[model samples]
Target: MTAQTGYQDHKTDRLARLRRVESQVRGVTRMAAEDRQYIDVLTQINAATHTVQEVALGLPDDHT
Candidate 1:
């Protein structure tokens, strides 16, 4: 079985994602200073992008 609520449920998830993105940015900065692998940094960035997209899609439409 599956269950769902509307935008209310999404709010927490979105905030959590934003926090993760913030952390990732910090990590990337550290990685750059340490001269980490390019592919590793790219993967982290890609994950952050997907998280943003998911949050955007979960938002409710004002017109609806």
Candidate 2:
């Protein structure tokens, strides 16, 4: 089989996850602008935090 070129699935998946994290960050910014409920904002922040941590942990040690 011919060797693959360019970005591979492993790298692509990591990038896709990071993109979602970026969206979550943008949502947090919007919440601040709209003066959302304190608890509401915190809840979203907590969810985003876990998403980031999961992505970080999922990456191979050598990559990190």
Candidate 3:
């Protein structure tokens, strides 16, 4: 789901999303380190990538 940032972007919202992505990355890293199945790790990697991309797309286009 795409978020509408408009003029006043919510700091808490952005931080929360970033934190979620960070947690996802950490989990994927741990899974890989523990020699988890390649397919399983790849699935998580794809999920994380999709989440990060979604967050990136939600950012406002205007710099100001």
Candidate 4:
């Protein structure tokens, strides 16, 4: 793909990943409010972070 196309695709992917991350964060908040285990909540947060990182790493640097 051309640089422009690549960047556009990257932006779309990043936005989608961010939406999922947002939901995961909300889930974590609800879990906390419900007195869920700290470790479990942290695990979910970690997983979300990892997923975001993977998506970011897969994107081309020029896309940023």
Cα shift from native, residue 19, model 1 (Å): 0.6
Candidate 3 lDDT by residue in tens digits, 1-64: 9875563465567677778888989998999899999999898888888877866776655334
Top lDDT model: 4
Evaluate model 2: give its lDDT: 0.80
Which one wins on TM-score? 2
Instruction: Tell me how far the alpha carbon of residue 48 in candidate 3 is from the true structure, in angstroms, after superposition.
Output: 1.2
- Residue 63 deviation, candidate 3, in Å? 6.1
Q: What is the lDDT of residue 41 in candidate 1?
A: 86
What's the lDDT for candidate 3?
A: 0.77
Give the Cα lDDT of each candidate. 0.78, 0.80, 0.77, 0.82
Per-residue lDDT tens digits for candidate 1, residues 1-64, read: 7755466645677789889988888888888889999999898888878877877776765124
lDDT string for model 4 (1-64, tens) is 6435565646777788888998999999999999999999999999789878877787767455
- For candidate 2, write residues 1-64 as lDDT tens digits: 8976334547777787788889988999999999999999898898889888877777655254
Instruction: Sort all candidates by TM-score, best to worst.
Output: 2, 1, 3, 4
The runs of at least 3 residues in candidate 3 whose Cα sits more than 4 Å from the true structure, single-residue gaps closed, are 1-8, 61-64
Better of 1 and 2 by TM-score: 2
Q: Of the candidates numbered 2 and 4, which has the greater lDDT value?
A: 4
Give the CA lDDT, 0 to 100, for residue 48 in model 3: 80
